[model samples]
Target chain A: MDDDRPLFFHVMAYADDADHDVIDMVSGDPDWEPPTALREGLREFADAPVADYQYPPSEGRGDLRDLLADRHDVPVERLVVTNGGGEANHLAMACGLEAHAGNEVILTDPVYPYYADRAELLGADVTYAPVADDGALDPETVRAVASEETALIVACSPNNPTGAVYGESVKRELTDIAEANDALYVSDEVYEAFDFSGRFHSALAFDSENVAVTNSFSKAMATTGLRVGYAILPDHLVDPVRTRHMLTNVAVTAPGQHAALKALRETPDDYYAETRAMLESRIEHFCEALDAAGAEYIQPQGAFYVLARFDGFPGTLDNTKRLIDEAGVAGMPGDAFGSAREEWLRFALVSPRADEAADRLAAYFS
Target chain B: MDDDRPLFFHVMAYADDADHDVIDMVSGDPDWEPPTALREGLREFADAPVADYQYPPSEGRGDLRDLLADRHDVPVERLVVTNGGGEANHLAMACGLEAHAGNEVILTDPVYPYYADRAELLGADVTYAPVADDGALDPETVRAVASEETALIVACSPNNPTGAVYGESVKRELTDIAEANDALYVSDEVYEAFDFSGRFHSALAFDSENVAVTNSFSKAMATTGLRVGYAILPDHLVDPVRTRHMLTNVAVTAPGQHAALKALRETPDDYYAETRAMLESRIEHFCEALDAAGAEYIQPQGAFYVLARFDGFPGTLDNTKRLIDEAGVAGMPGDAFGSAREEWLRFALVSPRADEAADRLAAYFS
Candidate 1:
């Protein structure tokens, strides 16, 4: 029942082999310009002294960590710069399992698949708590499923696929629930910058020791290829996470961090606002096409994904391939996430051709 | 008895806190300039299209993987580019344990600490096979430790601390031993480019499915900060390793891989030869100081470390700290490696101040 290969790669390979021109909506890689200062930083770092090319501190470059600490309003000791938000999440899960008494991890249904995959890789028993129909994970639902055996509870917001941004009350209650259950809550905020909803709230705002906030510049800075991210941990988890990070990755890319620092320092709020405006327009256009096709879709409140279900067209591996072949568009089948979303399909509005892809889908269905 | 902290960071922290000038001999981070072409590549990539700043293939950039596969004389399917040799080794060990029936891992005594740390982190039972006094692991010693329950056997050639390069015969026999024991042999060849003696041989020369060779450009290209490395896995292990890499790191840094690719394509043989020549001279000069100080030392056969023992100054943590405060030189306490070499201190000679540091050490002891 388990396909060890990630869903994105499986569908992507099929897309690559398609004879027709396929507009890719399956991958979350943003196809926008990165901050200009990031490129300038890369060029500048090409002339950095030899020591800068040797090794940054395992935790991270001092200045980058300091900047992240300032931004997050956490002490510098609470941060660890990672290879990406991927490694940050990996470290959090591993550390959570190690520190807690139980080997079980609680994840939201219609989950980001990597959370479940990583929990399994670290030998945790995973149990899913189904999200509400609106794609919001209720704290009560988490509390219902979580037991003393739950070592970790992982949630993402602004969420992937569903794009439901958890509000302050919801995040606070989830943190409290995890703390009561002796579980660590790993909140992936990688898409935080994409939140269009005013309700988006970080678990860090709750100031709970159980929460680890994982974020990356991949989505926000439009530079996933750079592979720079960080985990802001509770004081207790810092050392173990740092050591695990060191053993697993040694350190993040020096030049990437340098570029990220430059971008963070120099990129104006207008750049982010413009990006959000761009995505909002794409979302509006795509949702209109969905209406024309008579497909039911969750209008994303935050991240750049829309989950939709077309009547009589179940989102399965075969159907995903069919869409690539017949409709000239690619998307992730809902079953790739979890059982709760098996009849749905997820499309990332990352490509500039999002409108064209949406129109094609509308025409194919109509 | 477990400190949970890596020894390097512990000592390096003390070194950093020292008020006097301290020649850092504790870190293996090379001080040489990376290939000139690498800087050129970084500058060139600053102008790459937006797509290039998005995610590369999870396995790695295709051209970099192809180049590595060709260089190693392995099929492209055998390669999994990683964050560094650290992650490559972590993958090999984890995969080895998963694929084998046993949970026990055999490691060389005086081991690279990360090997043991990672094994424990993965919940494997670790046993040490002591190397010979000259710091060479005899195949028979490994054979003595092998059992049906042995999942992995790890070794490093041009070894850390001891600097003994294993020859072809020893490596071949080691592979045969692992195969006979139904175990995987992970050979860390990160220092392959630093072999000062003509004795260094990669376990890949044996062409055994039991062998996985891990290497990195961190040492060879002198760019540890770039975070680029790969593991040449046996056919059965590649898929699992690749999946683990994706879940853990997503992908290596695109810019770093681009730079590494350019350096690989353009670097002259003379560049490597000159590096080896420079290291050989340092080894010679450092050994001369050891003789003058009337200390016993293992003259390095390869790599850039010298393991030495003074008459009364044991390589304990206290003495290591004392050296930093008094002698103004920082070297790792050998006890940090493993119990087998607790009386010795390991000094990495990557600093341009290597001769001066050696002189300081000799005068301090005299």
Candidate 2:
């Protein structure tokens, strides 16, 4: 907890220190332009009266909540807008921990580091259930690990580091397991829009009342730094989550909310389709280059990342540093995600120059 | 902890429920525009690369940090830009609690409600040191309540609800006591710019290693909705505060930061002077009206709020409700700040319509 470099910061710092010409695939930030609606929305917001710049309702501005409520099909009362997907997830986890008469917060083995870091910060006991070799959840394995003592089970689909979209059956199993164990399912679907598989399933579809779905505009709208996200809570957790949200941040920033509201209302559905298409091409391009180099990798089903295994390397941190220094390419170490995947390296196909980054990796691996 | 209405939300709810003709002064949100520079800055930022909107450094962007460092004359390493002054206080208190070999987090009697809320949420044992009837701190009272069991001493200058600006000696004594008690002094100076008494002193001015100062652009920049604030930490608390900050809200929103950076760089010195002058006039006008109506009030030496005693009412909640329903004026109850001041009703002199609001109060009382 004391200065153990959180993975995101470590990767971003590595990218910053790399050569100016380095093809940075380390950070998850998308490189493409945001929708014109988002940029235009800022200008429109700037022109509004200063009163609009004052504190918004701590829960959120009503219009944005209504928009998201309709989009997610959740009641407006269950939603609490947050600073970003991170806060949304954090709030849900906090709620779970408080209600947790449990000993451990269960997470996937190859976890999003932020979740692990937050669990530690909140003093919740964390335990991991391993993902399949293909980085997909094995429902029984998760069920085997969870119990009345399991505070919450976190599921990330089109997952960070893995990009293995959980299949419908797996989603149903996890939801059922959480419901049976009296634990909450924190389904982080920030990557929902980026699914390569048309069959992206929300845990909410299962109707278990125990699910809290957290999502953000960061990845989908290409505005990660805007710090706006929301959580759809179970009826029981609504008041507590609202209280925690109020005590923690009061509300999300105003202009970001307005821009997000505008983006949701004005942007076309085709924009998401185009983004998916563009990112799929990038993923395929990178994987093909990796395939040509004969590297073992989990082909991403969704999200813009691929986890490639490199056996000859001297662990991930060393490999990542050498890769940045010698190959002029940057990707995250698998160990950064979790200790279980130390031989793997994760690449985010976020940059427009991702192809060049892949080619650099190919040459280095060869 | 079970749904006690936090002050701002409670007041805003009353305002929301009141008739359209209500003269609302319930919340502290300034009813004024942010500087022209801040508005124009958002326009400039909107055109930047999509990556610029993706994520900023978790601690903060260097340019903004550098600007704040120059402004506060603190080392850049000692500062952490937070979501708002609320977060700055939260993070600093977190550090103090972790370091405190103590049982209690010391607060001023009739304290800002958010601090107590945060302390309760963090599981810190909260104890109060009484402020004099004039809403001024008596250092000995704080010292008497504190010992090795004190984890933190929170001092708000241009204090909320009461607006009694602490003098130099009081700040020094508080810092010295915190140092002696092995506790941290979290001095919230968000209202530093609004101090009518030129004698306002910063805890940082004492040069105690135990001191941390939190401030924000919310009140000073008239951009509470923007949610940008910062803390200047003692060298020791820096890393822990950063960790807490990173975990709580990964980073402040980007455009808000850009606008804040612009405001800091481009706003003229006279803006602060003019704001103080305007708020002073409003406060003076309201107090004169209250005096004419034979109402007891504390003359605010700083900040924009005036807490008036309305003894005829049963309690603050009832008084505030009837005031909103009958008199068409809204303000927060003193009980919301703490249990010690239920007879008081806090009016934020933030609206351009402050004079009109005061007239309504006078007419109702008469």
Candidate 3:
């Protein structure tokens, strides 16, 4: 309803320009450094020859694709390297829309704004399937909206804004619905590695012919700015995806791909375990504080965000700004996400100082 | 018309698989290392904090934008860093089409295939104005095609495929026509530093509100894989470009922006001079051999490609494949560029062994 609602990045910038001592619970970016091996790879790439730094094979370098394919247990032909998860999702929608010859894309309400915005930008109509009360999908509701004109249905697991991790049953239903409707399913799994719920099931786990799963190294490797991400598509979609990719971003940055590959190969199992443990601990710490302050919020099952209800102020934007000015903390306004989220504020637990941030907000509410 | 023709990269890969000692004249990638400072900057960035590798300000890093602004003598608000010259051009067209709400985009005949493909991909109609026999733009011819529905006029000077460096008068005429028709002029100057004619001028040099100039460090720094390029937009167009960029690629890779900034700041003047000199020598060597072999070709005024007429074979694809199979050389077919040039083959002089390759061809012809 509020298309003119300012994006969180703009609000963050405005708060930053105000020059207050603000604690950032607003941004999705991790404050932790990437693995040492990944950083080291940058140096190695720098010292390589001109051709190494020149334009890569447009699909991607064979070695990196091989690594990705092996990791995903899919053939290299199914993957196309992209600028980030952003481009991967965009290409999937483009390919899906073309293949189905459809004009409409289906997204979940309280959606990741980028998905809704990009679909519109690409000249496709968007219809939302409202999230269930617990922030999980009800497959029947999604099915009701599907039609011959539906090109794609996008699902995010360990979802943004609300951290509900969709389980195997839900993912299967989504895959089935897409197949029955002749629409493609785009699974945004960039946050898959952050699933606190051990029940997280990949759409790839379904191994369905109509599903395309997109992931990025940003969240897992802590290198969001490097812009290396990819999609593993069904056999039928590869040609169109690769063609669109070649005409769009070409290939992801070479050094970033090199770094991601290094991180993938060398990052110890303990590293993920430890990072997940840290995020889980922070979520608990923040949620406990919210409880103590009598704040209403959903307990996260996966990912690092908490959607806390704060209807005291005029609206989400006003509440978010007031928090920034008064509590010296910044969080994303719910209205910026969707009309349904207007009474909630989404806080990211990406800061190393998450404890202090929670204390400040708790004190303000108390 | 044959959009299905194999790209040179595909042919090159096939040749490599055939295990021939191929002299690669197919790829337009420069065969020189990037500036030492830029590579060294990568190492520095690798050692920086997590914040350095996190998502940058969506448009770009402020420092890089500020530097670009100062270099171009424009305000920081006018620039948007992109994945590469590819994305910059894509965004320029997207912004132009939206602003004019028009369906048609104009490209020159014998055009870079990417522009035509991307325009069509974005759902805009494409019309071509033929380049003069010498490969330069004819102002009157272009003016005749400018209609109310012409949302964009794309010009690539020091042109790809043809290597024509448009002079000041023609560029002025283009800007005037665009302004008179309320159309946008997108000047792609990625090859700006490769101008050998000493007659090159940027559309930005015109200081018109209708012109948006896009450039990249790929050609000059030989860092095409780094995915960093920027566009200088008119003040009014900046918001649209910025919004489109945010929805599309998010931001250029962080390490790349850093590396490019270093290259922009510290590249010695002689690096460009030496590269130009090397290319000039290669062109002379190749053209001289062609003369001896009785081959007819357009002598490149700028850029690295020479469109040589080689109608000896049944078609350009046949000629190209035969050259690879027999002479152990690779090149792009003219049909890959446009139907009018199907009688020609495009050779890139970016190889260090350009002279030897030319000699091999000359001997084969004799």
Candidate 4:
């Protein structure tokens, strides 16, 4: 179903009209420099006589596949290039779930709407397993929700909204649950590089045949505009994904692909470390500000979001509109993430003005 | 299912060797400069702040859609954003062909392989209707091939491989055939700007419930690597296609979309005139060369491809291999296009080196 977000746009427009100094904390884009290498790569691509300016292989250029494979620690043949992890996840759910028309997808509750929305759009049944009080999935709970009619198990590690990275043991348990039920686990690891507490687990890392991993340059690389990502598919699924991607994009843009290839090849561990450092500091600042203000919240472990429960103002139903009307600061409403709790607001730690944003948010809650 | 490109990798490896001056004429990318306004728009965008780098509206950017709607003489709400026409076609096919196990696709023979391959991959029963002499469809032929079980009729105008733009009467016949048979007509007009003799009829221009149009920038703007195309689909089909596209690509790359918007908005008639002139000139030069070279061929009226038949070689199976090895010139084997006349070779008019290149081919044949 269409997410119907010109609704949010009207909110953004109203927020813009406010004369007060504004802090937009609802934005998902991380406040960080895209790696210098990525910049050079894009510039080089723009200048190159042919940075994939000619036709790329229908499946994708080998350099891209090889890099993706190495990163995933899989065979080069296991990867199929995609427009982004969105497509990767979409393809997996669309193609992998073909065995059953009404197969269930055990989506994490309070989830990235995409997880459930894509499944529904593809005509599959959805079973959202709400996060436990600890902000994590208990394997048994997931197992209870899945069924013989469940064709795919999808998870976002270093989860969106909550930023809870699945621990390895939990992932293994989920893997077993999927295996026992003959279900495919599709894990989105788009935010893997932002594991602030370092306990990131890939569902693919737990199992092979029943798991597919999808990743993208959107968050970690600060290249959301490029729309580059891929699925580390199981061998049998590669051809299907390739056909889908090719039939969809033909290939990603030449310049974007070159930039992606270059970024993947030359990314420094320090770049990720520096980014984590910034987010960690922002998280601490936000947590302290909220704590001082006596606001209820869950501190994010990874990803650049902090979910906090506000008593009277739970951010904005229309992104940033409520904040502009009342708080003078903007945040994503908990309702946006499909959380049962309607009073939670998300503060993006990626905003450069985190301290100012946090203070404004605290002031609003007060 | 993989398009069975058995010798695909071999040709790429051969191209990579750089030891010889191998001419790559097999690629469908025509040689032309992007419209100046498109470039100017990109320059403006490059200078604009990074805000445009954020998410696009699900319906597509309003400005681009407004212009596109104006160009098509359609209403703005009637349009939906797409990654490109490829996806528009795929989603339209998926939506048009309801959920079923054994749906069928009526494919034009020696046609664009993507239609047949994708339909097959999606589990549609792909049946072929032979392209008539001059690469146009006969109403009777389409009427004869359509079955009650058929879902999508994949039609390309100013057709690929064979450069014959289908006429309005033929489209009318095909439309009636699809309507009578309860099938959707998916039209690919990726080469809309290059109707060399000026007869590009959009199926949408006619009575259109079953007709959807797909087009791309690769051929028109000589930006093959940009990988941007879109479709103008029927109203009821909008949400399904939009959801599929958004789910496929979180969105097309911002810059590419920006560039495309600029191209359509800013590009002048002369820019198109020049592009047309270059292709028209190239077609003329090549045709004259082919006549002198004593090769039998279908004279192309539009699109940058000419199908030439070699008498000495009975099929392209040998001619393609021989041309690559002996002449170092590459045009796809006619068999690749599924023409019954296997001796024919499909030469993309992308290379301006036709004069010398034609001589080499003529000499090889002699």
Candidate 5:
């Protein structure tokens, strides 16, 4: 079946085509400088030998994979460099479905839409387990829905749209539930670098063959255009996913990987700290404007998103468009996510214009 | 079912791990310089605005797509930029299967292994239509294999391994056969720029709604590591393939695309002519050496490969390894392509060391 989820590009296009000046909060693309080292890396690659521009190992560059594996406390064989977190998730889900003896995939309600879209694309029957009102996914909800037919269970933290970071116990319990059901637990940790709560726990911490952790440099490095990311898969899943990756994309971009490796190695810790501080300030300012408008909003504990519910302004597609035209602001309709958040609007606080977007929303609603 | 095709990496690894210096002829990666403008493009992008580092349109960069659309004489909506020709082929095949009401796919007997691997990966039943001894595919063979159950027929012009360039008449007839059987003809033209013979013709000339043409910058620009490619698809297949590509790759690399765009715009025609001339010389030199070894070889009319059958030695995995160890030369076992070429060895003539590899083979055989 075709994916019925909202196309992000359509909303972005609407805002672009609007007559008035609109502060875009609909896109998750970070409006910040990538690390200086990344720029240097690109320049360095320009001078590399011709042979260096040929095919790299399909798995990834050995130095980069080895470095990542060391950082994650896993062997090099357990990881694969992918085109982006998108492909990483796709690979994990496809391999999970192939390895397990089932066709059903359990996902969180108010989920990141791509996860649901990928599950459906892979021909998995999807079942949603709704999270609590504050966006915390209770492992109990997952346990209640899981069955023998459940081939995969996908969870993201700090979660997109809602930004609830899963702690160690929650992650361990989710892994346990997946193992109990003979299913693979796919953990999307692309926002790991954005955790403000300090509660983010990687699924890799759990020593189980049932867990696959996917992450991307796009979000963390603020270089979404680079298309470099990876998956840390379990032992049994490694070869299958690598083969699938080879057959699908051949290999990740060699220059991108070269630049990523340079950035990963040379970027200072203070650079990340400064980014976190900047986003934390934007989040506080935006939440104040929401309070002024008398809107109920979840102040994200992690990640750069705020989910708000304005009375009499349910987040439907029509209203989302109306906000772009009349309010001079653009945010995603909550219905684009699952039913649980259908009455809310999700704004990505990645743009430097977050404050301007907040002011417009406050004024229009008032 | 899992693909049982020979892993190209394993062979390359064996050659790499060998004690002596080996002349590698197994990989099709070109050992030539990319357009000089590409390097300048990468350097220029290093100083680009911060906003440019965010996600590009998932389909591709707009300017690049428009340029390609104009060149191919297709509507921009009918084109999609992909990670590589590999993904372009994957998308075309998947969409073809989804659009048609059938499970069987017809392929060339000595096919590029990845096409068969992908068909099996997509769960399509594969049937082979054998090519003639000289590597010309007859439309009649495809017609004999076609039925109500066939969904797709794949063909490659300037074919890999065998290097057969399909002319206009053959392409038109193949497209006619596919149309009559209600199957999509997925024509891979990745080696479009490598055609030395005047016989090569694009399937796009047939003006059929059931044909999809896939090509890549990897071969033409000698930039396999850049990972940029595209598919010119039929109207009905465009949206489905775009959605699938978005879910799978998010997008191709930004800097790579930026460089590709610059190279495409600024590189002179002489650059391509020089590359072709170099390959033509290597082909002549390599064939003479093969003849000295008393090997019956198909002298490639186009592309950078030659298939040769030695008198007593069959091309098997063991023999491929032995050549790497003893002769200090590496070539692909013909069985990797398909059963029809099992007794022959395929050598890629991309390396500057092609003459050295040919010399090694001749001396070893003598």
Candidate 6:
């Protein structure tokens, strides 16, 4: 009963070893290097002498605070640095949801899957509110399922697997519900850079008290293994938890923080901009191929993923394996993303050269 | 309530802002650095020209695996490089306790605080049997609580905050009880290198299906900010929990792993010998001061911390604050560790120079 093995790892499993035609499409990992400015900044980092290796403040590096503060419009003290987007999600759910331990953590159905998986590991009871077949999280649906017993309301904008850019009205509704119930809203905005439709208001903007936004350099800056991310935490919830965070994993890697600080300073704008352009074009190309393949999806407005329905084709693990084994186009079944959409499959549009993915999709369908 | 601070960061926090008369007697962070030989080993890392910055195998780097295997006397596949020992411990428990989730995670009283805190966070009920008043986790106590419903037993040797080193006989006893119940034994040996007594034996030496050993370079190598540690897992448990390790914190830092690979090569043995000698003398000196101060504590056998009882002082947070404010010497209250021996305060022996702490302790008591 390895509950984790089959859970979504990445769209591609053996990507580094994949055959030319295997067409690796996996993870939210962007297949690119840090922006030019960020790389040049790395060279400049050597000058700081101390930048050779120094852990950031347990919460985050100061330069990163400035960048994130500007982007999220949150104060510096609210942030706490983590190893990556993964740790950010792990710690946010662990700390932010502390107000209502043992209560249900509400997650949108067709979730990123980690929200439930991590919440389960952290002892929070998980409840799901269904999104429409279009993959958009409806505010009414969220309201209908929300109760005083809910500990956290976790939703991702430019949602993973679905690519639904949650609207500002929906954001306000969720925030209002959380404010009323005193539950936290953990908005994972790792994909904030690629919001092709630009209304990227933070959940923090909606309400700071019940919101702890988590982001990372993994997607936009292409420094995933450098493993730097942070959560904007409310001040009152910061002390006793500080020791646990320290003792749980100790400080994050020193060089990683140093590199992240360099990246933020060197390419704060261009990193997100170039990645945004790349992601937008990839999403468009993938949507075109899906149309030609007669595959159905909401046509992603943001994020580097699309939930294409193989309504006619099989959506079982066997079908997913067949797609990889036969079509040579890899993807995770939408069924794994949600108990309801087993007939659909989610494809990660994470290719530095996504023209390859588009060609592969065309050839497979033909 | 800021339950998100990484464990073992306290040592660095204290070290960073070291005040006059400030003796950081808290976390088991060693006061040392990578040996000159290991520092030179950095050239090998830089020259090899591998992309160390990218994602490593979810298990770990190959050479590092070989080094860990050589050091721990375990097969390479049994090892997983983690962000730190806290992560290794969390992974060991998550993976080992898979079949026994709801059951009580057996931990000794006056615990490391982290063990109970992390286990509780992971949805396990934590039950404690008292260690000795002097802070040794007796084999007898571990045996008395061995139950079918007990998922895993946490044993810390050269114990944090206590400096209790479990003997060979005790480790064998623990292995026997855990084997009988088919429960896993996760021995956190982060303080492995600080053995003041030469009798340190690893639980990894005890042959059992349910035994996992976790240790870090923090104390032994004195690179807390580096945040590199590894877990030795046998064939049966590695696969189930391996994914969680990847999901929990992704990969350990590259430079830290490079540094740890150097730490693992124990050729001249001067650093370990010197660290042990220094720590041993400091423990002796501090205990003597405690004796003069009419305070009570077990003579520390290993590690860099000791739990001392100030009989008339009523070691509360208030007293701890007063000590920090007036005497400028800081130690941890026993209540922070576990419910047992709240009158006792844990003091770190890892000072920049030995006897500095002893001087502070003496002056404070007088």
Structural RMSD, model 6:
4.8
Q: Write the per-residue lDDT of candidate 4 for residues B154-180, one digit (tens) a residue.
A: 888888778888888888888887788
Worst 10 residues of 2 chain B by lDDT: B2-11
DockQ versus reference, model 6: 0.31
Q: What is the lDDT of residue A361 in candidate 5?
A: 83
Docking class of 3: medium
lDDT of 6 by residue, A1-366 (tens): 223334444435644344646766645555666655544443443333322333345555567677777766777677777878778777778776675533779898787776777777676788888888777778888788888888888888878877788878788888888777778888888877778777666777764577778888777776555677777766655553454456556567665676666666666576578777877888888888877777778777688888877546866666776777766677777666657677887787766556677767766775
lDDT of 3 by residue, A1-366 (tens): 122225676777767966678888877898876888899889888888888888887878789999999988888899888888888888888788888757889888788888888887778999999887678889898999999888899989989978989899999999999999888999999998898889898899878888999999889888889898999999888988887787767667999988888888898988888889999999999998888778888788898899887546534667677888898888888877767777788899999889988999788888
What DockQ, on C-alphas, does every prediction get?
A: 0.73, 0.79, 0.70, 0.49, 0.77, 0.31
Ranking by TM-score: 5, 2, 1, 3, 4, 6
Which regions of candidate 1 are displaced past 4 Å?
A1-6, B1-6
Worst 10 residues of 5 chain B by lDDT: B1-10
Residue lDDT tens for model 5, B1-366: 344334577788899999899988888898999999988889999989988898888889999999999988888988899998989999999999999878999999888888898988888999999999898888899999898899999989899878889899888988888888888999999999988897888898877998999998999999999999999999889888988998889888999999999999999999999999999999998888989899998778788999999889899989999999999989899888888999999999888888888888889888
TM-score of each: 0.96, 0.97, 0.96, 0.90, 0.97, 0.82
Clashing pairs in 4: B84-B229, B84-B230, B85-B229, B85-B230, B158-B165
Query: Which CAPRI level is candidate 1?
Result: medium
Highest DockQ among the candidates is held by which one? Answer: 2
Residue A208 alpha-carbon offset, candidate 3, angstroms: 2.1
RMSD of 1: 1.9
True contacts kept of each: 0.88, 0.85, 0.84, 0.53, 0.85, 0.41
Point out the higher-scoring one by lDDT: 2 or 3: 2
lDDT of model 4, residue B13 = 55
lDDT of each prediction vs. the true structure? 0.90, 0.86, 0.85, 0.73, 0.90, 0.71
**TM-score of chain A taken by itself, candidate 6:** 0.90
The DockQ-derived docking category for candidate 4 is acceptable
- Write down the TM-score for model 6: 0.82
